[model samples]
Target: FEAGLLETLAPLAGVAVEARVASAPAEKTRKARFDEAMLFTHRGLSGPAILQISSYWREGEPIVAAMAPDHDVFEVLKAAKAANGRQAVHTALSQIVPRRLAENLCAREGVAGNLADLSDKALRRLDQAVNAWTVKPVGSEGYRTAEVTLGGIDTAALDQQTLAVKSVPGLYFIGEAVDVTGWLGGYNFQWAWSSGWAAGQVC
Candidate 1:
């Protein structure tokens, strides 16, 4: 267990591949493809996907996490079983996700041995773990780890083009100080540069 933990940054790395906030039942049941990687930490979960979703995440909110975002987990695994029933479950799963991740899932779920040994119910359980896993975070890692805050000055109160305060002629609100928050990566930076440039142009 010690060696396994040391080998992976996320103990449940592959299991939480792509995650987004799920505040409602419909949202939780729906499928989504996150264009970012999700990482598992001892604290909870993090990564581009989780980080982007964090802005919408509230305390006590549950997140819908997908292990295999690209394929239908039930049908895909069933097909693999039909083609190679004698193959280990982890072997088949590794073909869908990362090998290390498959191994972790297999160990956690007690899913091992040949695919032929697995019943339809077992297959469904495996599919759910990969496609529709639900996770409820205690809370976020907080501002210390937060890349951006959600709101500041209301966008409506400012000039949309110049980012200048509508009521105050010389005052301007820009960057993270405004109510505009963007996705992770260079998006926020780009907004900063663009908004700063716009504000500078007229201020």
Candidate 2:
């Protein structure tokens, strides 16, 4: 929160939702799923899920989010419909997600009235909204708030064993200044320490 970065599309601010996010088909690398806590901020989405996905995300490419990752939302909604036919759709959905998020999702899907009144198709759409919410981020906070960065000096320019600049004798580049980057965790820190140690050995 102190970083004040990674602004996303405005909608579900203040809502905390655990999601399984994955890169879109347009992603440059192999698709990997990031399951973590997602927080809706006043400007956009943040927290672990978004930060992890942002490494693979490019502008204009959509990211798929399984909001209800543990539950089959379609089946849940259908079961709710059967168990309590008179309950409102949003009311039933609130049991799965936050109440405000449920209302917003219901409004977005244009679903209302008793669960029994909703068609299977309508319920399915709502299920999609909850389980497969897709959105393209307009922009990110960039390096100002980035935990790590990509696209530094190419790794090929340096000796793999010593992290020394092969063309420039006695010169070395290590850590974030190099192209090596890792997923969200202490992997980046490990790279920093190991690379620095390698260079420290021979530099």
Candidate 3:
């Protein structure tokens, strides 16, 4: 586990979506992105995509989610409108995202009624809602449920090649104890093994 899962204050507890999510853009914040599954829990957001971006997410910043990552949402909605103008807006959106989420988003965005009644601008707004939904996370699960902790002994204090403490000759910091952190996959495990091996050679 690590200390990098996000918690949201929104009413999205039971919804899950496969989205391409990105950390908020800012001058000093490193924007992290992931295209994977995300679950809306009673407390906040979780799952692979949320966990990956949490490392780069800063407090008070909004994260962006591309709900229909593989499709052009505007085009889809427009096409749906053309195909069957009587179809409900949210119903058409459900083709892109989960049904619950589609309805929720449509409600939140103040878009409703049949697609035939919607203008090009209205469709664009729905596109933004589907493709670029941004939510500000209240906080994170912290170290308790985190996949791996983020900060550690600064890499500058250690010899990169050997993972040895530059100032303390025999001392070495490896894996999660060092400043190196990988994504949700096996990179962190590999780091632990590789760093330990590098230090083992001469330590």
- Which residue pairs collide in model 2, if any? 8-44
Total backbone clashes of candidate 3, pairs 3 or more residues apart or in separate chains? 8
Model 1 worst lDDT run, 10 consecutive residues: 24-33
After the best TM-score superposition of candidate 3, give how far the Cα of residue 120 lies from its true spot, in angstroms: 2.1
Better of 1 and 3 by TM-score: 3
Off by over 4 Å in 3: 1-12
What ordering of candidates by lDDT runs from best to worst?
2, 3, 1
Query: For residues 1-203, what per-residue lDDT tens digits would candidate 3 score against the true structure?
Result: 11233322245677888889998768554977899998877777788999999888888889998977998989999999999999999999999888888887888778999999999998899889888888877778777898977889999999879998889978989999988889888999999999999999987
Candidate of highest lDDT: 2
lDDT of each: 0.74, 0.86, 0.85
In TM-score terms, candidate 3 sits at: 0.88
TM-score of each: 0.78, 0.91, 0.88
Model 2 regions more than 4 Å off: 1-11
lDDT of 1 by residue, 52-129 (tens): 777766676567777677777678779988998998988988888777777877776778889989987877887887
Model 1 alpha-carbon drift over 4 Å, by segment: 1-10, 13-33
